[model samples]
Target: DVKVTQSSRYLVKRTGEKVFLECVQDMDHENMFWYRQDPGLGLRLIYFSYDVKMKEKGDIPEGYSVSREKKERFSLILESASTNQTSMYLCASSLLGLWATEQYFGPGTRLTVT
Candidate 1:
């Protein structure tokens, strides 16, 4: 079974603090993605990596960045936490070149910035 794990299930931080959210996939997938879920806006892509050491900025990458140093690991970094940035962060992985393949998701991390 494809398993995706997140470093934390919940996080709380004060404004301006740096936050790191880590994700790892057991499957040897080539595409990993980071997304933030908001009430009205729904799930918005934050960043994604198609290959190790290759990343692409998503819709809301202004306050966030990502790293994919290893094939199974992907990390999301919030440079400066803010109230508006507080949301449920999700990580997903899928096999490369297989558009129809299901993407496995990790348990989302709910972050609250005070």
Candidate 2:
């Protein structure tokens, strides 16, 4: 089975603090993504990389960025954490061009900005 690992299970930060979240996948999926899951908003994409060193901004890219230096690793960086940014961040990966490509998600990192 494919595995995706997140760096933190929970995090607490002050408003305006810079934060970094890491993700690693065992499967060599071509598509990688970072999303913030909010109560009502659901999973809103932050960024995704289709290939190593190549990235594209997703729907909700504000306040966040991503890095894909290797096929197995992807990182999400929050330039400045905010109170409204308190949410569960999920990392996912999928195989490109698969008709029913379902994203495999990590356990998620719940961040609370105070």
Candidate 3:
């Protein structure tokens, strides 16, 4: 069975601290995405990668970045954490092309920046 996992289910960080959220997929997917979910804003994309070492900015990429050095691993980095950055971080993976519609998601990490 395919699985996507997040490094943490919940995280707490102080403002101005550097934060790293990790996600891994065992499905050998060709695409990975990072999204932040808030109450009213819904799911806002932060970053996405179509291939290793290649990434693209998404809707809300100001305080975030991503790395996909290896096919199975994708990492989301918060350059400097802030209270406004607190949200539920979701990681998803999908096959490239037409199969991209079927995405597998991790449990998600709820991060609180104080």
Among all candidates shown, the one with the greatest TM-score? 3
Q: Which stretches of model 2 miss by more than 4 angstroms? A: 98-100
Q: Look at candidate 1 and tell me the lDDT of residue 42.
A: 87
Worst ten in a row by lDDT for model 2: 94-103
lDDT of 3 by residue, 1-114 (tens): 779999999999999999999999998899999999999888888999999999999988998888999999999999999999989999999999974598888999999999
Give the root-mean-square deviation of each candidate in angstroms.
Answer: 1.0, 1.0, 0.8
* lDDT tens readout by residue for model 1, 1-114: 889999999999999999999999998999999999999898999999999999999998998989999999999999999999989999999998856477889999999999
lDDT of 1 at 64: 92
lDDT of 2 by residue, 1-114 (tens): 989999999999999898999999999999999999998888999999999999999998988888889998999998888898899999999988859479999999999999
Off by over 4 Å in 3: none
TM-score of each: 0.96, 0.95, 0.97
As for TM-score, the candidate ahead, 1 or 3, is 3
For all candidates in order, the CA lDDT equals: 0.94, 0.93, 0.94
lDDT accuracy of residue 11 in candidate 2: 97
